[model samples]
Target chain A: MTSVEHSPLTRKLSAFVALTKAELAVLDRLHKRRRIFRAGHDMVHQGQSAQTAFILYEGWVCSYKLQADGTRQIVDVQVPGDFLGLRSVLLRTSDHSFEPIVDIEAVEVRASDLLEAFAQTPRLATAILWAASRDEAMVVEHLVGIGRRDADVRMAHFLLELGARLALVGMGRAEGFDCPLTQYHLADTLGLSAVHVNRTLRQLRERGLVTFRDGHVRFHDHQGLVDLAEFDPAYLDQTGPLLT
Target chain B: MTSVEHSPLTRKLSAFVALTKAELAVLDRLHKRRRIFRAGHDMVHQGQSAQTAFILYEGWVCSYKLQADGTRQIVDVQVPGDFLGLRSVLLRTSDHSFEPIVDIEAVEVRASDLLEAFAQTPRLATAILWAASRDEAMVVEHLVGIGRRDADVRMAHFLLELGARLALVGMGRAEGFDCPLTQYHLADTLGLSAVHVNRTLRQLRERGLVTFRDGHVRFHDHQGLVDLAEFDPAYLDQTGPLLT
Candidate 1:
């Protein structure tokens, strides 16, 4: 395939469309190439309309909401092959913000264009619907993590889940992964203090459950970490494509 | 209409069917009317197949899950004209339990049946997709309530949202409503102690915001309560028929 066909936006959609053989031509036509943003650039604002959906090709981004008191809640991390701005498409409004954590290259697809394609292809529509459900389930799991689970369990589950998702998209290695997420972002996500997050990471590394350094994580005993987190992957059953 | 035509289950389905005529016939055939235990009976267990989706026709129900230590978290409250078991419908497995809060009459639709209807009707499929999305937004709001809002604000938002949803299906009065939920259930839902819930209710009544007695609640100053809770009705949009 030509480099144009192998672009990150196309790569992301193709990964999905390859499973279902659903219509991608419309999306391909609507695709317009956009440049990379430097680290610390804002991709989406909390209260503004994020009219574009993005597929992260390189680098990382954080979805978060800021409070009036200068506090922030980091909601989710967008990685390669992951599309952010999906939840906003349904609401026709944006309720969160996205900021690039590193120099980022991503593909942006207009919501209207995607909806138009969905209107034409039932299979594509089904796939998109399933993706949205999977996204919501992730949020629910996060709620369960923060509301009920202890801090250690929450962090372990987050790492395990992230590794699994990234591996599925061929972004992570089998036993370890590249996650350029800072302890500050992780703390915001788990509703803990940054100091607490740093301490937890140190403990994990000391105990050999996982080791984090140089923007990479090594899962020394994946099953042990899962057992500690009580992590079950059943909540994420985006299996419709596989089933068909 | 004849009495059979006006059956509670039939009436509820018809109201939902009014919005999706094509999908209604498909759903009607798959729907089975069954009477299980009366008020306070568990409809579905956690970690089960989640084979059936219930549409409440009379009385109320709730969805909840428990931690390993036996602490319960009430996820959602279901009343007449509402579709219970929606989360499990997509997940294909019940991660939560469903129980009727009062003497309940409902129709159970199998998941395979709903999926068939979704495959056949475009509008219905779109509505269901939107229904799931709307449920997600509610979950997000709940997270905010649990993590950020005060006790009184959380309770007020819950009551007003429930009132608006129930009123849509002709189950509530102009200024009040009958929900049949217990203080314990309310406490679990709000993540507050029972004593705290009681005190908050007393405060609400004393402030002329709301009045509750005998499972019925009356809003003294609905707008005032809305203002206090910062309740936005956009989260409860009824653009769809049954699930919304």
Candidate 2:
């Protein structure tokens, strides 16, 4: 419960809304009960009653649904500072399961405690709603990419998006980031096969647009990738007022 | 502003939380401006500043994103009782556009007025949050379907979900529902070509588990179709308590 002014969650929330010192202290205190999970660990399972919300302090996690045919669809990827299970606080049970993509550390916050904080500070509630709305917008954009875009465009868009999101928290440069995802993870997220993902990555490499190697992706030509993918960051809604 | 107790919006809110008589009156007054649009009309366009929210009183509308290449991705289909632009009120501009699939009647509620209502009634605010959470959950499920399921299972799951949602507002039965979407709409929503959608429909008809023709769908064997699709309604969160 020490000073969390420089924490990733603080940085994320400050981007949207300015919080009072007391408010930050409250949030820091609320985000307690630190836990760690190894890669491939199910942080939460589908059909499970949602009792806790987690804030990723480090590493990556994915929320996905497993089909009857044993295939997985990664609905979303969580980076540092992203709040997991915010929506689950309002629902009875989780609709999708969550798994750690790599070794991870997270703080478990009680849903009731978070709701109480919302009641105490309406601005925090609005910020949470804004975050949720942006999440929905990103999901919609991902749907468009998966539904219409070719593998090349999809991979480019995905890489550019990851770079931008990581940059928001000062984690990556404009053209590159430390990507921990494998071809299988990309396949699950982009609705492509592992082979297709590999081929798409090769095509991008051949075109001199991007490179994915050693768990990192570096864009040689960011604008070219953006143009090829028709990637627009407006859907992220990062420029909106924090409190409205 | 007269008695809206039995209105679709009222029913929708009631399903989540109990509303007092005074709250109902306030909601009725807020939902004052009524408007109508024909099929294929865009109710809200991308990049538009969302100043108002709309409640679909009748007919169907879809929120979609139209790519530069002219392909459309229907992100969500709205039936009666669904609130539009709840998220838009928080964001600067809409990321996706909305269009009506059939002639639609909607009641316009000012975003400022809705905010006022939320400030006055904390329970109403929680209910709205709950509704928004459910919307996000549905979008995530749709993502899973598009990303993982094949054409047949996807179609079956889509139809059953529509039937269940329509049944919520007393618009359809367990075994049948009036469907206004064309094969083109189905194709756009499911990420398939129009020809593929047609072929899939034919396959389902040939299987004798479901019949969709002339804007109507009858499930001859509801359980059979459900089993085939592995459709589960828990993601819809329809059975949760109306109020926390």
Candidate 3:
């Protein structure tokens, strides 16, 4: 583990503090700086005690669950400035697993520290709970997508959503954002076959709606993709100076 | 329209206020009491502008989403004092519809009323938002149920969950609750055919696990249902008296 002097860790904590300054400062002070992980590493395991919650400083992480048969469902993907393990934090039990998808760095705060901070700052409690609520809502929207929408629409909707979220955190460029995700990951998230994900991605690229290579994606026609996906960001309810 | 002068209404409001006093009071003041509807009336429609949220004062309601092809998924059933339209309130649009299963009395608060109240009380705001968050999270759990668990397990899980929620608001008795529902309704909720629901209900009955007929259900062996469903109430997170 290194000190919080590093750029990635500093920037991420500052972003969370921007959302709830005084409270997150309490969290930031309690956090112990942790070493960066390589592209593939498990931060938490399913059914195990969730000891800490992470604020993703740099790179991506995924929250997922696995079946007895070894099949996995990627419940969510966490990017920079996103809060991980908030659901488990409230539940007092871990329901999913977390894995870093790229070279990763984060500040890990103990559950006790989080509970102490929540006890002191009601606003932070509200913010974290709201964050968890929004996370669950995203899962609801995804359920609707997979249960009802056609495959093409589902894939397009996912890409559009990823682009929007990444753009909000300044990780995205003018055209698109780095995907930094594989077809296998997309398959697990969307509940599709890996081959189907690959084909869909190819279709998206061939239509000139998006471009992706080497883990980076560039939207050639962002509005077109939005239309194709029938995407509307309204449910996100982006509010206040905090999320901004 | 009339005042909430009836005992049932008062009792239902009490449960809500018990969990969220001043906030529910603000909400209670907003409603102009309305007549209970017959079994078939639609409370809200999918893809429609949702004007208000409702709390069941007596009887039951069902929340459901309809497909483009007209297939319906009855996601959750609302018992006495249960919350509905909160999802629509949060999203600013209704993506599903609801209807009374019987003649049902309810208190309705306009979304404006809720927003105004939130503006005044941060604690109330947190409570309502947390309530909505729980609703949204239940929908996610439903997704997991259908996507992963088998039919019998799903049915058992659904019953266990409903019973718990009903118990929370005092609709359920110590041992079991009056079922207050039909096989068809359970079928729709579980994404199964009515015949399948009937068969599963029979299975639970014959195994000395449950008893149901004539709008009443008793858990003959409550632990059996728990084991059958792999039921876990951790997801409910029904803690904290601040917001009930």
Candidate 4:
């Protein structure tokens, strides 16, 4: 494997690990069983016995749990390099569902394959665990947003964090990023009503912080939003491979 | 190591792993460096560089993040079997603070020791990872409760989940358990005010479902509370070690 084989997973992991050539070869093999899933449909459902995990390479997906009242709470959105259903694969069941927001390209990773890979490559396993920790950190941050922060700050923080994550994989920037999510998605993700999401976005736009329209999230005042949300990237920042 | 040497951690991990005597010996090594932390003080603070983690052997602690407005959200409560600061230690920093609700007994585990332990005992590593997944699952459930469920259901679900976790370590039961948390802690945890928590408890008690008074939670109608909260223990249930 060479530089030509560099991928979002490789790139993200590289931020933490100085991967060897052999490591790259193993990672490339893991990416072999690629598949495409359609938009607006579930790729995995809550409570299903999970046999295979996924490494998302392209497009967006939202992991959510449906309630008896017909409402859903989007736990986290998956972009390129995110491993869908990986956490619960070892646990034997999926606690939530993953719905592709658009056509998605992902590699299916069986449990045995993943375990074998972990056995063969300790550094790569560490990097993967590091990524999982980041995912959990994002969820913790989301918990803080919903439990403590106000609606406007929560919305701002959510957009800013999304941009930061997308930036990791070269899909976004601090200024703005193209987003396929609608206000309804925002409402579900932020624990706000559809009307409240609309008003919150309007308020943010008026304050020159950010705008969520035209299928894009435009950050008019990136620093302002960060200040308003008290957004910190320290948790998401992995300086180098600590495993060494 | 044998059944006589079993501790809370051994008990919790045993649910997911048939740990060998050799593995149990290594797990016991991790139980060294035990310390006692006083109540009403933080053992780990947010944003601090974390070098070591702890295995809670006894007592309770709350992990929380403070907002700029002098408000804090209790992310999760740690019981006897909980692993405090374990998640963020490898990541290099603590994102939340752990304050003991009562005097706590814990065993300090350094990063090097934990990594070495993992290398020496892969099965125990897998079991530890399984426990971490269970912790993340609880956080996800908490997210759902805050994002979707009403105040009453959220409190009921929160208490029931706490009972379930404590029961795993032989500290709680279906009827009730002693709790050290105050109304302020409940307010922070449930994303409600003290007034709201008081009212919610009163309502539950009036309906003969539960009571939170005199530092104890008495479940008068356990089944009724479970039904009201739509509580599911499947996520927390691990029949046996999947690693083997």
Residue lDDT tens for model 2, A14-109: 776778877787777877678889999798898888756788889999988888778888888999888787666667777878899899998887
* Models ranked on lDDT: 4, 2, 1, 3
Go through the candidates in order and give each one's C-alpha lDDT: 0.70, 0.81, 0.67, 0.85
Candidate DockQ values, in order, are 0.27, 0.59, 0.20, 0.56
lDDT, residue A56, model 3: 79
- Residue pairs that clash (backbone atoms under 3 angstroms), model 3: none
TM-score of 1: 0.82
Task: Tell me the lDDT of model 2 at B80.
Answer: 93
> Which clashing pairs does model 2 show?
A16-A242, B16-B242, B17-B242
Model 2 ranges off by over 4 Å: A20-26, A240-244, B20-26, B240-244
Q: Rank the candidates by TM-score, best first.
A: 4, 2, 1, 3
TM-score of each model, paired residue for residue: 0.82, 0.93, 0.73, 0.94
List model 4 lDDT by residue over A1-244, tens digit each.
Answer: 2331568888788777788888888888888788999999899889888867898998999999999999999999999988998766667788889999999998888877766666666666666766777787889899999988899989988998899888888899878999999889999999999999999999999988888888999998899999998988888865656654
Scored against the native two-chain complex, candidate 4 gets a DockQ of 0.56
Worst 10 residues of 1 chain B by lDDT: B1-10
Residue A49's lDDT in candidate 2: 86
